[model samples]
Target chain A: MLYLDLTLQGLIQGSMYALIAVGLTLVYGLLRILHVAHAGLFTLGAYIAVTVTNAAGSLLLAALVAVPLVGLAGMAIYRLLYEPILHRPPFVALIASIGLFICMEEGFRLVFGPYGNSFDLSPVEGSVQLGALSLQTVEAATIVAAFGLLGALAVFAGRTRIGVAWRATVTDPEMAQSFGIDTVKVRYLNFFIGSALAAVAGVLVALLNNFVEPTMGSVPSYKMLAIIVLGGLGNVKGTLVASLALGVMESFGTIYAGHIMDRDAIAFLFLVAVLMVRPQGLFGKA
Target chain B: MGAYELSLLTLIGINVLLALSLNLITGFCGQISLGHAAFYGVGAYTAAMLTKAGIGFAPALVAGAAGAALLGLIVGIASLRVRADFLAITTMGVGFLFLGVVRQQEWLGGELGISQISESGLGETGFLLLVLGLAAGVFAISLYIKRSWMGFAFDSIADDEDTARTVGIDVARYKLVAFALGTAIAGVAGGLYAHYARIIVPDAFGFTVSISILAMVVVGGIGSTVGVLIAAVLLTLMPELFRFINDYKLLLYGGLLLLTMRFSPAGLAGLARLGWTAGRKAERRPA
Candidate 1:
């Protein structure tokens, strides 16, 4: 029963990881750069969602506005900073992203204060009992929402023209350009979609935890990077699998290792080991 | 030196060293380290503890460098297999874990940090002069390395590691050397910092410091030693010069980083490069 409970908890957590990782992997798959501040956007999404929900009195409606707002912010960032410098060296882009991260962190700190903010979003009100088991309402909803989002993403990426353009850009940006694909447009669209997904994940997370903080999003960013490496860069299914596997290992590892192995360290060690033994990752194409 | 001038000078000297050290890894070797403050912290803590245990400042400084270099060597070994961005993420993880260790350990003084560190025999003004001297020494050494075979190896590795590897250069070995050398410098800087500040805390060496170092390199120009020095000097002086904006130091720091990179992608080094090229051309045509 304990094992069952842990597995359930791990799966729920893994779902959230998948949502965040998928957004990050989407951008990396296309740009081949680590947008370090994308995590800041994720942080923004949570704050905006919480603030909106408090003002508007509806979690769903708050998320609806927050996602697009975050998406537009991503678009504005790319247009104002990334596009002109896209021709520059990759490091410059990275530095810019890091700068963006700092700006967001400071801005949020100024507005929200260093201490965290909590929101009342858990519809569960408590926990549900089953045959020799129990599960929180919020946790169950997170898993369901994660699967729904992933399914929708799979369909969108597979069947849509915009998705096809993004896929082509990821495969080869220059060649896609030669083939009449507007790489910049694709980037804008992808950033929008990716930022929206991250925002939605932030919203889902707020529901699960019932609180938000300025610094809460940073650890998850590192964890998502680890998942991307372990799953194989550019492989979406790989990210999902890796996140779930890591979630299980971490859940069990915490139980046995007695906090000696933190979730971040465990994920990081997995990434290091993978990069060492198989730089291509488990499912990443060589 | 007056108080304000002395303080600015000290800060510039320290930051210049820190930025230059980071340049060896990020600028020359093309490895991005988002968590360099860990190395800085390691050096500071090791030096402080040793000095507190009755060791003299000079030996403690050496010990700090050696300890930081050893840690860097270990990290290099653990990290060399990964590619660029992945390596950045991994280092960040190590950094967070290091902060956690520093935070939790009681004997290391926990969060309150070690205080009452005895100053070097030099008085405050004399210490500032000494720090400036050390800064000049470091600049000379960094420039020499930038012009030598080792610098060539690092540049080639940065340009294309695979090509360098094919040309019989040991990419991993050179990277380890850069890591060790850069971290050793950071360690020495940390020692100087502890003695000057008269207090050492883990919180002092966090992501913000790392970001500042990265900013210095980015604003300075990665592969250009002079650019990094100028950047370090300007950035350090800015906060002290405009005390009103101290709370927004990070905001302005981020803004400056973005503006510099966008406007001068090659950084201050770009101007240096142009001057050198023009001088060479003039010499060839007239003489």
Candidate 2:
């Protein structure tokens, strides 16, 4: 029963990881640049959601407002900060992203204060029990929402013209451009969708943890770096699989080796192990 | 100089060492490490613990550097297969792991950290001179390396590893050497920082510090020792100079980084070079 409970909890957390990791992977696929500032976008989404939820008294309204705002912020960041350096070495964009990350994190600190904000939404008052296992309402919501978002994304990417354009751009931007597709617009759309996914994960995380802090996104962002690498860089399906695996490993690691190995250390050690053992990742194609 | 000014100068010296160290790896070797602070922390803790155990300062510093170099070798080897963004993330993870270990281990002083690190007995003036002398020594070494065959190998690897390898340059060995040398310097800086501050906390060497050091290198002009030195001094003092806008200092720093990368990818040194060349061209035209 305890094991089953842990599995359920792991899946819930893993779902959030999948959402965040997929966003990172998508951006990496579209642009060779790793958006370190994506974490800032995640934090912004959470803070904005918190502010909106507190003011308007509706979680749905908060998501509707904050997600788009964060998405626009992502697009704006690309245009203002990234577009000029797109042709430069990847490191230049990376350093710029790091700088943007610092600005956004510090900005959040100055605006929201350096403390955690309680997620003002009331808790869903019940839990569902199945056989010997029980799941909290928020956990269920997180799992459902994560899968729903990912499924919607998979379908959109598979069925739609924009999705085909996106995949084409990912495959080869110059080739896609030669095909009359606006690679630049595709990149912007990619950023928007990725940022939106991160925003949803951010809000879901706040709901699960019941608090949002300025630095809340930092650790997860680093962990998601590990996840993306574990899933073989820009592989979407691999990212989802790696996220769940990491979630489960973390759950069990916290249970058994929590005293010896710090929970954070476990994730990193797993990352190192993966890098050492299978540099291409488990599900990644060579 | 006043105590405040002397301490600030000492800090700049330490930061210069750190920036130069990172410049060696990232700027010169073309390997990005987001965990440079982990080496710094390792050096600090090693020196602090050894000195706390009554070891001599010289030996403690060496141990700190050696310890960091060892960790650097391990990380370098582990991340050998990865490149660019993958390498950056790997090093970043290593940094987090270092902090996590420090926070969890009571022997390393855990969250409370180690304090009352016995002074170097060199006081502020003497310590400043010591740090300055060491910084100059490291600067000379960097210049030598920059002009040597090793520099050529690093440059080739940075430009294109496969090509370098095809040309018979042992990319792996040189990369490990760069990692070891850079991390060793970072460890020395950390040791100096620990002794000077008389207290060491794991939090002091987190990702922010790593980013700050990287910022110093990039803003200074990657691979230029003198540029790194000047940039280090400028960034370290900028916060103090602009105390009125203290809250927005990081934001300003970030903005400066973005602007610098966009306009002058080579940093201040690059800008200076460009101006020099343009002035020469104008003078020749007039002639």
Candidate with top lDDT is: 2
Scored against the true structure, residue B271 in model 2 reaches a CA lDDT of 88
DockQ-based CAPRI category assigned to the predicted complex of candidate 1: acceptable
Q: What DockQ would candidate 2 receive versus the native complex?
A: 0.63
Q: Across residues A81-174, which tens digit of lDDT does each residue of candidate 2 receive?
A: 8898888988899888888888888889888999879766563557877677777787888888889999999999999999999999999988
**Best-matching candidate per DockQ:** 2
lDDT digits (tens) for residues B1-287 of candidate 1: 57878777887888888998999888878887877888888989999999899999899999999988988887787567676776787677667666766765677887788999887778879889878888898889888988999989999988988999999999989999999999999998888898888898887887778889988888888878889999898888787788977888998888777777777877778867878999999989954
Model 1 residue B246 lDDT? 86
lDDT for each candidate structure: 0.82, 0.88
Error of 2 at B20 (Å): 0.9
What RMSD, rounded to one decimal, does every model reach? 3.5, 1.7
